[model samples]
Target: MNTQPLDDAGGPTAGELGEHAVIEAIVAAAPSSSNGDDAAVLTHAAPNSQVVATTDMLVEGRHFRRDWSTPEEVGKKAIVQNFADIEAMGARAVAALLAVSVPAETPVSFFERLAAGIESRVAEYSAELVGGDVVSGDQLVISVTAIGSLGGNLPSLRLDRARVGQRVVAHGKIGWSAAGMALLERFGRENVPEDLTEVVAAHCAPYLTPGRGVVARATGATSMTDSSDGLVVDLTTIAARSGVSVDLFAEAIAPGPELVRAGEVLGVDPWQWVLTGGEDHTLVATTANDVPSGFREIGRVGKQSGDPAVTVDGAAPHYHGGWVSF
Candidate 1:
């Protein structure tokens, strides 16, 4: 009953282990804590004193379209996503461990720019790129794992306490990037504006500076999660985990002119891109007190015994749903 799961040294990839089985193995091996999850649990019963860790990945073609994105964009996207995960837990990502696989003929400047991009993101987030591995592969892929620390506050979870009617606000522009994607897809790169094109750049190059995560904690948030998957997915995660509900207004999702422009160019409904697009990497959190400036109120959370649904102007969120790997 005490057989330690051997670490994968050279053969049999780590993912070959069943996810649930891997989780159980990790929990079994970890220095015990009451919190059954991997993010982090208190070491001593004092609470608010501990270390935290999270790992996340960004796959090629799925997370980014190489035809459209640059190497630096790829690097920044990889780092920021993991950092956002640490942020969602109400912690600061102090360091990054990155792994990148690129083709043999890839340019040397490509790697320098990629490293520069990582350094830029680290500098942006006040995080350091501590270590990583580089290998040759058929396609470009980048994965980053971040270790963070709780600086005095209790680690925030998507599952946590909240009063009914707490305000849910996110710190970043909700749908601009998705609009940018639509613009590029519909207008073939030349038609989009420099302003909106920057949004496209942001979609590729996510900007989650170190201090933004603290802003989530400072706002009296009861629960928090990053918008890596999408706005509704993570909002729904917090709601489901905390047994609450949220009301989101589309108009309040930030006045995205790029959305309008993209919709116009493609003859597609702009709301679909706004409501369901993925990879914005914003922080959707619940707060009881006043929402800070630049933080837009998109929804509210309350007790509801059903699907962790989001309401659009008091109705459920509806769209075809966005990007799926499987």
Candidate 2:
């Protein structure tokens, strides 16, 4: 990989580098022993263990904007989202495959930075970037397939496993990404408040504690999901699938001080982001046993009554919005 500075303006383009050189750069940026073959050959799973896999895609302009985020941040966000799905299933990520599509004129430096970003995040989770593909297209497109291991004797955490009387628990922030996105959209990146820069970073590349899903599973989590589509929407999915209804506590899940300050600046209710905003990748689970360490009790599951599958303070939420891929 080129170590010198090469901004988009005067850098060598993918078209100029040719496919072979571009792929070699990417592999050099993120090398793995599992690479160099036609396909990645993963190790055998542990005794009585199962393999878990999930895929997610990000398209330039639709999922992200170059003006708002760096190529590195885009790579990290793409990897994080896919790995979060793996963890949500009560598994530990073991390997990942990345596929990228970009215009022929795209800068080679962009991919180098992107590969570094993906490799860094994958390393943080102790997962391997086994193999991937690069292709030419009109716009940048990134797709990741994360492979995980549900270690011996543990059942895969499924959305429909929640039962009536289980306590709903959550780990990690719920609305920081949305708040950051709001800050960026309303104030632009350069003008964001100093105190709110962290929020902006969260929107760019959300982070979650790795292996929390296994912790939740060991702690008797019955159902689990990541807050990729907002708290209410995800819980609603759990409820509908599990034949139960969820009633969240307002105070338990309310926005914190930073969010409150952001709300004041934006004149938008912070609770709206807490309930309706998405992509924080927070872990939410239902457990009949004690709430696991690093997790807080936020709500409880009940027999499905009708109409609203999820509610806060036993009432329907005023903010019904959440990310809809459509």
Candidate 3:
């Protein structure tokens, strides 16, 4: 997987420079004071607004594979996950702190590309990378803590806010990530069909719009979350938290041709992917009135009879929920 060995004069290995030098190189272009400070000091644009922060980690061989994703892709995904978390609270992404653990033999170019990826993605929302730390480990591990602003007056959209009789809406694509993972697992990186290229890309690094979560709040969305986990699982979180049940109308969610084609290739039901597959970063929300533009209705919130439940087309989904750590 080495594009060129770090031993080459053009690219140095991490061990060649040692930890302090490696860290200086990694944080050289960072926008935040975290590079030199013992701790980063932050102040919000709207001092009256509430602050929202979230952290996420990606470990090699667990969350991703070097063969399937480039260092930049992994870095971008690490930022996106934390950004999505802030957005889930109906807030604007503001800043990030990164931490990494990599093997001594890793190439220095990998750090350069990874830092570039984080900077590029966060720059979409005018966010900053305030600070981070680097250390040695058996494999690559990335941790990101993203901070966001609610901007004074807007109420945060949370998992516990969905009400019975509200419409459950979605604002991004779904199932493609799962389909992409399936293709990668079955075909590896060789001889992939042209039709599956998009699906494969989704699994590698699903697209995420920076400010969609704030838009959901402005649209009067009662509750919101990104589909980091399976649709049913994340929806179930809202349902349980709000003491409501959610019934998804499968007919309302029309899987695209790409997803259906991937399913056909895998001999599995595409709806299962829609119902249980995750990591699409799709925005799912509930609102009493009509959803805003770019949003679509797929389900409804209802009073929980006894236990909070999530169902598809009035029945339980056959597939298991996604990305179980255990």
Question: Using lDDT as the measure, which candidate wins?
Answer: 2
TM-score for each model:
0.79, 0.95, 0.92
**Candidate 2 error regions (>4 Å):** 1-9
Q: Could you tell which candidate, 1 or 2, scores higher by TM-score? A: 2
Model 3 C-alpha lDDT per residue in residues 1-326, reported as the tens digit of each score: 23332223447778787777667666764555544688877763687888789998888778877667766677788888889889888899989988989788877777777787788888887888888888988888889999898975768988999999999998778888888888877877454588788788778777777788888888789899999888989999999899999988877775789988988898889887887887888889999988766778999998895543987777776665676887
The lDDT values for all models are 0.65, 0.88, 0.81
* Model 2 alpha-carbon miss at residue 154, Å: 2.4
TM-score: the better of candidates 2 and 3: 2
Q: Write the per-residue lDDT of candidate 1 for residues 1-326, one digit (tens) a residue.
A: 11211111233232343333323432332222332443333233335555667877776656766556666677788777888888877776767766666555444445555666777777666656665555667876777888777777555655556457998878766666677677656544445566567767767677755666667776567677777666777666676767777778766874467667657766877777667777777877778888855476877776774753666777677763655668
Rank the models by lDDT, top first: 2, 3, 1
- Let me know the TM-score candidate 3 reaches against the reference structure: 0.92
User: Positional deviation of 203 in candidate 2, in angstroms?
Assistant: 0.8
Worst 10 residues of 1 by lDDT: 1-10
Candidate 1 accuracy as TM-score? 0.79
